[model samples]
Target chain A: MTSLPKHPPAKRLGLAIDLDTCVGCHACATNCKEWNTGGISAPLTDVNAYQAEQRGVWFNRVYTYEVGGEGPDARTVHFPKNCLHCEQPACVTVCPTGASYKRSEDGIVLVDHDKCIGCKLCSWACPYGNREYDEHVGVMKKCTLCVDKIYNQNLPEVDRVPACVAACPAKARHFGDFADPNSTVSKLTRDRGGYDLAPETGYLPTSKYLPPRPGKRSEAMPAAAPAPAIAGAGRFLKWVDRVLTR
Target chain B: MHPAYSVIFFTTASGAGYGLLVLAAIFAISGLMPATAWLGFVTNGLALGLIAGGLLSSTFHLGHPERAWRALTQWRSSWLSREGVLAVATFVPAGLFAIGWVFLGTTTGFFGWMGAAAAVLAVATVISTSMIYASLITIRQWNNGIVPVAYLVLGLMSGAVLLEAVTRLFGVHGSHVDVVAIVLIVVGWLVKLAYWHSADTGLVKTTLATATGLGRFGSVRLLEQPHTEENFLMQEMGFVVARKHARRLRAIAQATLFVVPLAATIASLFVAPMVAMVLALVAVVSLAVGLLTERWLFFAEAKHDCMVYYGR
Candidate 1:
């Protein structure tokens, strides 16, 4: 049962994250925790909640990186990471129990907690470190892409999306079927040159990350010359000048 | 790569057990070993005991040890599952062989074939165990051709040393056994040396640039971590051992696992039967300590692909 689906899924539901727009506010991560703790994979337990060494299971995480060298060309890029729902997920195949599985219908990888033995092999198999082991529950958990809410008919249609996508303040996270060429995610991927992370690993991740676009600051503004030093300026005047110049 | 003690014990003990089973089968089939009921009980009991104890110890690290049986269901794709199934299946033939040899005092007819079957299954079980680590592409040190070969050679080497010790207890002299043990020890060390060399010099292609898909922007450096505190991923995969300490441990492993054991085994050959027994036992003890250190290093030195994300 841990074997991969024999046939490709009809739809690949995935996310397209825009590094250009992500603010690294952790809104998506928090929103995901907020929903998933009660949505499907509930009780995302945190160990030592009030202590100095607090840790817990989370489906999404945002990282901040300084790209390029320390120069004018250098830029800070906020990266949000999660499971790619890979086409060739080793995590699923490595499970001794048929707990970790990929859906042949929608290409979404999920963990069935009931069947999981919590041997932690799947965690070792994941290159992206997306799978989280809940010590309290003694099972593996990961990003479900908000499976429960995405297809729910109870809420308004506009609210029917992944909790992370719905909560992103910058509108940086887009979700749709990647298998469809005309879908929003696919179009965004094509137009913005979205790319996979560590493609050499050959997991064939479904989710894509849009590269940060060139900033307009370099093109629009030239370096300004330093203002002339005020000769023998009063202390009060020097403070005002310093504030104005800054 | 945490070097969990349970796993180290499991692999080492079970590997030696299987090796002993294979060697015992071969000796029995060739009429090299005595066909006494006492010898049969001692050899088979010791081998099966080690195998069962190691298998049981492996379950201690699992979060849900009670549900461990479910692991047998996925042998079609999982090496761990295959190992579980094979480990259990081996007991059938091995048990029958033990019963026939110990009670019936005959190993040449039906029981001999059962012993042969058990030997094959035992080797397969060890290979499956090695594949559990070798098949993992995430850890460069484990995903090597040398991993499986080193495992098999070391298992057999340890088993040979133990066999020498046990045979010496009965005042049985087999010069060829000592020669095989010496050769296997030398060959095992050679394989281990190659494994270490490859691990030390191997280049990891995935860097921070490739990990974050930001190579075009130039060098990428982590400015901030995703969480304020260390998470499970960091605690588990981000484990880093000091270079200085690793080098020291490697030296200790080489001395205890190889040099001391080899010296003891060679020294045992020319001594009196009683002295030989003591020396062979010393070799076994040294080898066990050495193997534990080596196994610890195996996990400690491994660098996981996910560590690149944590700036490790």
Candidate 2:
């Protein structure tokens, strides 16, 4: 029952993250927690929220990496990571029960909570460290790609995207069908040379990341306008003025 | 990779069970041992008890122990499912063989074939158990020919040692069984050493750069972690052991599992029957401790591929 499909899905729905513009604010991660706690995979457990080591299950997480050497090439890249919804996800195939499976229609991998025994083999099988165990619920939890919100009829058409996609202030995350060449995510990947997170592992993930643009310096500090030169008494007055103003 | 005690005990104890079953059946079938009722009862009881205890202990590690039966449903794709199915199937023939030989006193003719069938099933179950770890591509140390080979060989070797002890207890001493145990022990040690060599020599094909797909930019380092506190992934896969400590454990394993047992087994042939039985029993205890330590290291030393993202 955990065997993979013989052929890839006709419409591979996924996300394309633009690393060039991610500001590392963690809005997506926060937004994911906000939405999913009340959404399809509800009440993401927190073992001890008020105590030390307050760990909670999150579908989205952000990491910062120093990609290049020091000096001009040095830059901190903000990486937002989640399930890639792989075409050949080991997590699905490694499940001992039929609980873990992939949808043939849209290629989203999911766990059937009723059937899950929570053996944790799927967590070991994933090289990306996406799936995590919910100790309180005694089952595995993962990113459902906001499947409920995306297809819901209660919400407005424009607000139907994933919470992470909706909350990204920099417009770094794009959600669309990747199978169609004309789709927005497909075009973004094609145009920006988006690549998989761990291509060497060869899971053939549907999600792609647009690598940070080289040496553009979007975060460069703007030069401050020169302050008027002040005499000894005037400088003292200016200092007092700034201090008293605050 | 955290070396959970439940799993450690399960693999080692169950392996010994299956191994003992294989050799006991073989000895009965080949007419090497007499079809004594007490011998059959004691040996089969010990084997079945170990297998059942080990299997039961494994369930405590699962989050939903009541739903553990559902694990057997996905045998077509899951090695764990196949192991569960095979482990249960092995019990049928092994139970039959035990019943026929111990109760009916039929060790030759039709029951001998049943004994043989039980032996084959035991071997298949052990192999299936080995494949549960060996098939995982994420753990490079386990995804090799050596893992399965080591499991099969060690299972047989441990079983052979137990078989020798049981035979000695029943006043049945034979140099042939000792010789077989010696060869299996030596082969097990050699395979283990070879496995260690392979793992030590850059078995990892993925690196931090390759795993992150940022090698073209230059050397990548983790400036900050995704979480300030430890998460599930870190707890499960972030187990690390110092090389110095690991080396010491390896030496301990070699001496107790192979060297001590080998020497005791060899000395048993020259010693008096009373002393020989004591030596054989010593070998069993030492080998059990040794296998436990080895299994612990097996989990402790494995580096999950996902750790690359954390700059491991």
Tens-place lDDT digits, model 1, residues B98-123? 89888998777899999999999998
- Show model 1 residue runs off by greater than 4 Å: A215-217, A220-246
TM-score for chain B in model 1 = 0.98
Tens-place lDDT per residue, model 2, B164-272, is: 8999999976877898899999999999999888778845777877766777788799988888888888889988753449999999989999999999999998989
| TM score of chain A per candidate | 0.89, 0.89
Query: What is the lDDT of every predicted structure here?
Result: 0.91, 0.88
Clashing pairs in 2: none
Q: Whose lDDT is greatest here? A: 1
Say what the interface RMSD of candidate 1 is.
Answer: 0.7
